[model samples]
Target: MSLSIGLVVHASRRGVFEEAVEPVSGVSLKWVTYGHERDIRPHVQSLVDGHALDGLLVGAVPYRACRDVLPRTLPVAVTRNSALDLALALGQAQARGWQAVPVSIDTFDHEVVCEVTESLHLDRTRVTCLPYADDQSVDEICAFHRRSLHDGDGYVITARTAVLRQSRGDLRVLNGSPTPSSIRSELRELLLRIRSERAGAAGFAAGVFCVSRHGCPGDPERSRMDLLHLLRATPELTDAWIENRGRRGVVVLGRRTLFERLSRDWLVAPVLDRAQESLNVPVSAGFGVGSSARTSVVLAERAAVRAESENRPCGYLMEDSGLVLGPIGPGGLGGPGGPGGRSAGQWTGPPTARPHREQGDRMRELARTVGLSPATLSRLAAIEHDVAGRAVTPSELADAMAVTDPSGRRLVRKLHAHGLVTSEGWAQTHRKGRPTGLYRLAIVAALTGSADGHALETV
Candidate 1:
C-alpha cells in the first residue's frame, strides 16, 4: 500500500522539500506551508484532521509550534540542518568573497559550528554561535544578529525564515536551511519507520482463553469446549479462528490489528468480562503479537498464565517487543484502571486482603531478598514462566527481556550468584559462533518459597 505523508515547512523552504520528495515512489505528500511559525499550528491541525497520514516530516520550528496538536501515535521525523549544510553555506559565502571569520550563526548547535570552523582552518574564537532553543523567538534571534553586526561581525547566518526576511535589508544574512540531501535522508528514515509499524500491525496475533479451575469445577475438556463456544459466539472475534488449545484452554488466531481494535489498543477487552458473566465462571484471556504463529501462540500462552495468576476474570496482552499490558477487568474502558494506568506488577484487587495482593507482597519480598526491584523481578518471573523450566542462553534471555546482550550476561551472572539460576551445558545454536552457555531460571520456585530451601528465604 502507498503511504500518505504530511510535510510541514516554511514557505521559503517548501520548494526544496517538494523537489526532494518528487522522485520518491509509493508516497503521497500533504503539504502544510506557513510564512511564520505562529501560523503553523492551525494548518498542521487541518492537515492531520483531513488526512490519514502514515507519517509526518517537519522542521524544528514547526515541530515545536505544533507538537501539542500532533497525535501521540503518529510517526514523526524532525528534520534539522546537519554539519554538511553548515559547511556548504560557509563554502558559498567564501566563494562570494565574504570573510568566514567574525561571523555570527544561529539555530545550529555549537559543536556543529566548531567542527566546520576547525575543518576550514578558520579562527574559532572569532565566530559567535547561538544554539537553538525550544522557547526562542524570531525577534530574539533578529536582535542577536543586530548586536553581532553592530559589534563589527562580517555577516550573520540564520536557519529561521522570519529572522532572515526581517533583517535582509540591513544585515548580510545567509540562509542556513538544511540542504535537499539532509531533508531526503530524514524523509527516508521516517518512511522506513512507518513501514515497520505497518508490518507489525499486520503481524500474527494469538489469543488464549483458559477457564479458572476454582471458578468452574467440572471436567477439564468440557470447560475447554465451553470456552471455545463462547469465543466463537463473540461478534468481535468473528474473523478469528477459534479452536481448543489444551485441557482447559481455547485459542484464537487472527491479525494483530484485529486484537488491537477489539481490546481497544490493548487497554481493555470487554469481551472477556462478557464471557465470564455468560459462562458463570472466571475466564482469563491472553493476547500476543509476534512475527510467526508459534512465537505468537507461545507468548499468548505465557500471557494467559499471567492472567491466571491474578485468579480472576481478567486479560493481558504481550508483544514480542517486550511490552506487557494488563489485568484488564471491570471499569477498564476509558477509566483510570486501564492498561497503562497501573504498574505492570501491581494487583488490581482492593487495598485490603486479597490473594493477588498477598502474592504481590510475597514477590516484592523475594525481590528485596535478591537485591532487585519488584518490577525487574516481575519481568524475570515472566521469563521463567515462559521458558517452563527449560534451560536458556543469555542471548535468548536478552531477547525476552528486551535488553542488550551485555546487560543480559550481567543479569545471568547476578542470578547465578543469588542461586536463582544454575548453569547447564553449552549449545551451538549458530554454526559460526562458539557454543553459548545455558542457565535454567528458578525465579518461580523462589517466589513460591521452594528454591532449594536455603539460598532464598521463604517470603
Candidate 2:
C-alpha cells in the first residue's frame, strides 16, 4: 500500500521537512494552515473523522501547534521522527551502559533507526535486519521472552511495547524511561556484562525492555577543538566525581577556576595554536588536571558542561573523564600555575622558569593507555577517509594536529618525538615568538597507519 502524509502547519511557517516521514517514492503530502488555535482542532478532527491520512506527522518546524490536537485513531508520527525512541534509547544506553544494537525491522525498511544508527556511528555488528514478525500481538511478545534469555544479544526491535509486554505471559516486565545522553554508557555496560558474564544476582531474568519519551542526543559531538585543546593543555587534571548510577554524561568533580587572572579568550590563543592554523573555525577550551588515581566520568561531565556553558558556543572540554583520575590533592588542581601553567614556548611568570614542565611525561601515559602516542593523538581531526575508507593524507594529518602542512616544523617535531620521523634542521631561537626551521619524518605512515595507533599532539 502506498503511504500518504498529511502536514498541519501554521500560516507563517514555510519549507517544512518531511524526508524523515515520507518515503523517497511511496509517500505523498497534503497540508492545512492554521492562523490560530480554533482553525487547527477542527481540521485535525475532520481529517481523523474522514480518514484522510494514513499517518499524521506533527511538529514545531512549521505548524507544530497541531501535534497535541491530532486524534489517536491513526498512527500519529511526531515531526521529529523517532526522536523519542532515539532519546530514550540513547539515555538508556548511557544509563545502563549498553552498546547500541542497530536492528532493522523486517519487510518494511525501518529507515528512522537506520539513519540514526549511521549518524551515531554505531558498530555495524550491533545493527542488523531481522525478518518482520506480523504477529505483533500478545503472542509475539511471548515469543520475544524466549528469545531474550537464550542469547542476550543487543537487539533493536521496532514493535509496540505495550503489546510486547502483554505477550510475555510469565516473564517480569521491567519498565523505565532512559535519558538521551546515557544511551552510549548503558550500551557499554551491557556489552561488558555480556563479554565477562558479569550478570547480577537477579538471576533467571528473561530480558530487559526500555521505552524512552525523549530521543538520543544526535551525536557524541565536541564542538570546535576547544575541548581537545583544554584536555591537552591541562596535563595535571584527573577524574573525580562519578555518575554511573543510571545516566551517562553527568559527573561532578572538584572545581578548578581556569582563569583566576588570565581570562578564557587570552588562554585559547596558545592552547589551540596549531589547530587554529589549520581549521578556519577558531576554538576555545575548559579543562583542569588532577591525580590519576580514580578514573571517574564526573570530571569529563563537568568539563564538558563548563565548556558548553561558560566557554563560547564551539567551546568544549576533554578532561580526564574516565581515562585518567586520582585522589583529593593539595591545590584543588587549578590555581596560579596549576596544570596548564607553561604557556607553550613563551613563558609568563613572577620568576623566570623553563618551558619544559615535564607535562609531556604525564601525557605520555594517557596516550599509551589509549594505545597510541601523544603526538598521534594530538593530530586528531575529522579528515576525509580514503576511497575505501582508510588512510590519512599528510594534509589530513596536519589538520588533525592543527598544523598547516604535514612536513611542517611542528609536525616534524611531533613525528620525531614519536620515532616516526627524523629531523635535519633543529634550530633554536632566543626570540619569544614561534619556532622555525622545517624538517620531515624518517618514513611517512600517513596513509597506512591506524588513527588509534598514533597519539594526538598537544592541541
Candidate 3:
C-alpha cells in the first residue's frame, strides 16, 4: 500500500522507479550523465521528447554535451540541497546581466509581478503566464512559451538540454580545448569582428563566455583558448584600464545551457577534458538561465551539485571515480578523455577529468537534496554572487536584491548575518577629485543556507 522510487537505472529500463522510493526518505536521482551523450542521451531524451516524470535530476558530463542537450529549458538548479537552493532565475534577467523572459504561472499578485518585471527591466509586453498541470507540466509549458517567444533574442531557458544544446559551436571552439594556439586563433577572429562593430568605444565592453569559458579555470591553455574565443567573438571585450563603478565588468560569453549546467554541474564534474595530457582540477563554473539573477543562480546551484558529485581528483567518471555515487545515473563513463573531451555527450555532458583539490577545495558544499526551484538558499547565493558583488557596502547588496535596503548597511550586515560576505575598509581613489570607500572580497565564497544565513560556511 505504499509507493517507491528508483533513483538510478542501468541498461535495464523496465523497472518501476516508483518502486525504489522510500517515503519520508532522501531525494531520488532522476537523470545522471557520465559526460557522454551516448552514456546518457536515451534516458534523458524522454525528458525533451515530451515524456513526463515527477522531477528532473539533470547532470552534464561536459560543456558541449550540455550545449547540445539544453537548447531550451531545464532551467537548471544550482544546488542539490533544497534548503540552500533558491530558484532565483525562473524568469528574472537583470540580476544575471543577460537578456531573458519570465514564464508566469498565474500565481503571483499582478502588482508584485509588475514590480519584479520593472525592476528586472524586462519588456512589459513580453511577460506571460500559464497554468501548470502538476509540476511535470512546468517543463512542457515553459518549452511551449519559449517557442512562442521565438528563439532569437537572449533567453534563460530551463532543462539542462536547453542550456547544453542552445549554443552554436562558434562559441565552443574558442574554449573547446583551450590551448595557446587555439586562443590565438579565436582572438584573431574575435578582434576582427569587434573592430567591425563598435569600432570606437573607449571603455570596456561586455564579454560573454560560451561553452569554452564555462569551466576553463583548471586548464589555463583552455582558459586562454576560451578567452581568445570570446575575444574573437566579441573583440571590444578588452581588459580595460579604467574600472567601471570601481569594478571590472567581464562578460564571459557563456551559453545558457552551459551556464545552466555550470550552475549545478561545475561542482559535480569540474574537469571536462585534458590539456596536454594532464588532468584538470577542481574548476569552478556558473549557470545563468531565464532573465533574472535568480534564474542564473538556479542554474548555478544545479551545476554546482553535478560538479561536486561527479568530479574526482584524477581524471574520472561519475561511476568510476570513487565519488560517493549518489543515486544519479549515467552508466560508467565511456572512457578517459584527451584534450577538451570532445563527444556528443561532452557536447551534451561528456565525462570529464580533474587534477586535485584539498578537502577544503570547494567554495560551496551545499547538502545534496532535491527540488529544481530551490526555495530560499538559491536566493542567498544569488545575493552574494550577483547582487552583493555589486555593492560598495552591505546596504547596496540589500537594495540590489530588491529586498529591504533601509540604511544601505545590508552588505556586510546581511552577509555577516547570513555568513556569506566579509568586508575590508573603504579606500580612496582619484576619479573626480573625491575620495571613496572601496570594499574587497573578504570571505564571499558561495555557500548554501536560509535567508537567516545559519547554514552557510566556507567550503
TM-score of each: 0.63, 0.20, 0.20
Every candidate's lDDT: 0.74, 0.35, 0.31
Could you tally the backbone clashes for each prediction? 0, 66, 115
Tens digits of per-residue lDDT for model 1 on 64-144?
789888886677777776778889888878988998877889987654675577778888767888877777888898888
Task: Candidate 1: count the clashes.
Answer: 0
lDDT of 1 at 227: 70
Cα displacement (angstroms), candidate 3, residue 253, comes to: 33
RMSD of each: 14.3, 25.8, 24.6
Error of 3 at 26 (Å): 21
TM-score between candidate 2 and the true structure: 0.20
Q: Which of the two, 1 or 2, has more lDDT?
A: 1
Identify the runs in model 1 with alpha carbons over 4 angstroms from their true place: 38-55, 65-75, 93-103, 110-127, 146-150, 169-172, 212-222, 278-280, 330-459
Q: Pick the candidate with the highest TM-score.
A: 1
